[model samples]
Target: MKLVVRVKLLPTPLQAAALEATLHACNGAATWAAQVAFERDARRPLGLRKHAYAEIRERWGLGAQAAQHAIKKACDAYTTLKANLRGGRYGRPGTKRHTRALSKPVVFRPEAAQPYDDRMLSWQHQTRTVSIWTTAGRLKGVVFTGQAEQLAVLAEYRQGESDLVRQGGEWFLIATCELPENTLNAHPVGFVGVDLGIVNIAVTSDGECHSGRRINRQRENDRALRSKLQKKGTKSAKRRAKKRASKEARRNKDINHKISKRIVAEAERTGRGIALEELTGIRERARLSKPQRTTLHSWPFAQLGSFIAYKAKKAGVPVVHVNPAYTSQECSQCHHTARSNRPSQARFACKVCGFVEHADHNSSHNISRRGWMAWVCGARSTAPALMLVA
Candidate 1:
């Protein structure tokens, strides 16, 4: 498994200036290369590399590897744009349409940030520092610190390419490390259902709920603040709003990490696999009022699901996503599938069998059953039984 561990860099003023200069040069080269590649219709990595290599190295005063990396970054952006066009996500017609230009003043490619080998960018275990390459020269003994667990992983796992990111006035080294996959344990005895919703972030078949109330309230406060700041229409106000948005995002992400960890740990401890609803394209399909749309769009169901899956993989616990057709409206006890079964957001009362339960809990129970069915018969066969309810 590959995981990225972000280490905070403690660089002196001079070192920081050099690092920033290097990033600026690299991003400038990347932007130029992207424009050249687009105009010349050279989108492939090698083609773009060939077109930009010599010119970028000479003009930007970047190393050979850095120049190549910059070209690769440009090519990657073009590839993404092409993909979006192919997927009909561009929402416009022509393949040769004008592409958006890079606006960031400082961005570093992996090679620009590090090097081909550890000689230029390597960790010193004894000093707890790292050596990083820059445009001016190599910066040795730059202190970098991460969480103890992440530092331990860095000590053991093989480090791969990394990017040097500057966020909110702080520099961070985001390194990708390759870790050995955990051996799968015995097959799970049962499945734990995890229902994801807007009101509650997640609810398990075991009746545990991770409420999204706090997150929603925080977002509301941030939204109001953002509105007031925008009304001021001042540069400082805009900057403050941006910073607050970043902080809010970090807070929400931390909460998600904690919730996902707990959910995966629950399944691991119980020796059970996790069952989740398949929510792909949910946003596009769901019909909602303005308020409902805003709530649904802000909810991070996909991110939470991804976190759970990755964590479960590390813990040797399986995760399966089942059909989400009527997990909420269907009665878990009576096998009744009707909108009337779920009369309210929180209540689920089956008219046919007089079954009553919390709506989300009932959905979770159904999700768990669907997951078990999938585990037994495979995902393909689980859909036919999706409407069966019980």
Candidate 2:
């Protein structure tokens, strides 16, 4: 499995200036190359390189590798844009969003992250320093710091390219680490099913609830602060709003990490697999009021599930993604299916057998049983069509 490790780069003022210049030059070249490709309707990397390679090298004072990388980056952006168009991510054809996206050539920000190959960047794990190529020259001996575990991972498994990023007045390098996957547990005693939701965040078959009430409060506060700052309409206010947005994202990722670690640890210790729900197409299918929609859109259910899956994989714990349909509406105790089984958002009751339980907890139990069945039946573990046949 591939993991990413981020470490802070403590560059000297001169080195930082050189990095800034390099980013500005590379992104400028990329923007120019993309514009040329869009005008000529050229989508192939080879074609773009043929047209813009030497130009970028000479005009932007980039070396051979850097110029090629810049052009390749522009081509990759177009590829992504083309995929988005085909996938209806910008809306269907003739829609305002889709038409607007087609109206402009792609542009790169001056400080956007840039990928560096081993030729351009080298790390000194023992000394906690890096040597990176910059516009001025090769910037060497730039000190870096990260969590102890992350540093260890970098030393042992770091591989391939790394991205140099400048965010919120700091420099960071996101290094790719190809860690070995643990031996998978083929025979598990049971499964720990996790139900992900906006209110509760996560509920396990063991009746453990990881509430999102506090995180929801924090999100609301963040939204309010950003709205107020944006309304103030000052440069400093806008800057603060950006900072808050980044901070909120960091918090979301941190919380997901903690939750996933604990869940995977518990499953590994108990010799049980993990079960998650197939929540694809949820945003498109769900209908809610404005406030509810805001909460749903902001909730990090997918991130939590991904965190759980990768951590479980690292721990040799099997993971199954079960069909989410009717999990909340079906009664776990009596196998009765009805919309009325969920009397409220948080409560479940089975009318046929006079059974009741917390809604999320009941859903988790149903999911766990389904996971066991799927595993025994040799069905695709992550298939979304593993139907519940209660």
Candidate 3:
């Protein structure tokens, strides 16, 4: 039940530079550690090399603890993957052999970064402030907090609403503490089906659809701006370039938040479990025109899934993701499967059984039905029957 929330960090120009430098140092350390392990493993596998860890430490000039940590991480990754390969789900090798970069990513669990304070810092936007070590840099009174509105973003973090992290020029945080265990209302038990598409963002089996038109327009505009900026290639162009980049990133996040909230709210209102497509071969199977590929890539489907899952968990409702193999082609009413069932992108007319419905709506219904079957057959492990919403 962990949740994270991310807000923009507005620091003075000098402070920004210092933070950037700190990140680079972290990445550099990780890279050197990874190289040390790679060189050792290449010489001899762990079975033959008794001095593998020692060699990496001496060769890479890394401290004892850092060398040990890197090798341990590498070995754990390899072993986990090797096990997965031996137990093939569909008789295909599952060994993920590709190694990630040294600075793959850093995760802070209870406390993200170092220098943890025994006592938690209270949130006081007007009076509370930030300071850095003097020896690290001869700087004082760096303005870490901007306007009241900017600092307002931290209120959720301070109130124990989410966790936070800063990485790769962005911030990500989740609030895990105050998630409500169940909704406080009385409604009949049911299920809601969700259909994911490339055009319209999502269509619910409950006769509600969320449009992705605005997001699509924004991406198109970004592409056109990129073309223009590439041609201009001046200082002003560069400034404008950064501005658009930041704006678009924020825009995409906001859209995802809104769409997720809407879906959660709809499910809560109906006192129903959520049924979503467990998209397996989505990327390879997506049939979009070349011009639409970029926009489709940025749709944030995984984030949407996470948002729905966490929200449902908080509300004491169940969220189910079903195999999406035939949700698009199967008839919700009669279970008919044929290309003729969907005469057009927007229409669904079953051939075996004369059932007519909207394409997305039919897909959503099928998704919900599949989830119901899973529930009846006790196929899902983590999911149990949802108690009454009240």
Candidate 3 Cα misplacement greater than 4 A, ranges: 7-188, 224-246, 287-295, 379-390
On lDDT, the stronger of 2 and 3 is 2
Q: Which candidate should be chosen as best, given lDDT against the real structure? A: 2
Residue 83 lDDT, candidate 2, scale 0-100:
97
| True lDDT of residue 278, candidate 2 | 79
Q: What ranges in model 1 sit over 4 Å off? A: 45-51, 95-119, 380-390
TM-score of each: 0.87, 0.91, 0.63
Q: With candidate 2 superimposed using the best TM-score fit, by how many Å does residue 21's alpha carbon deviate from the native?
A: 0.6
lDDT of 1 by residue, 1-390 (tens): 777677789999999898888888888888888888867878777887777789998999988778887887877877776676667674556433423322222233423443234544778866878888888988888888777887787778746676787866778877667766676544778889998887888899999999668877877787789889999989999999889887876776777788888988989888988898888889876767887787788766776777777777777888888888888888898779999887888999999999999999999999999998888876421111011000
lDDT of 2 by residue, 37-122 (tens): 99988767899888899899889999888988898899999899989999999999999999989989999999999999999999
Q: Give residue 301's error in model 1 in angstroms.
A: 1.2
RMSD of each: 5.7, 4.5, 8.1
lDDT for model 2 comes to: 0.86
lDDT of 2 at 282: 84
Off by over 4 Å in 2: 230-234, 284-290, 381-390
User: How many residue pairs clash in model 2?
Assistant: 0
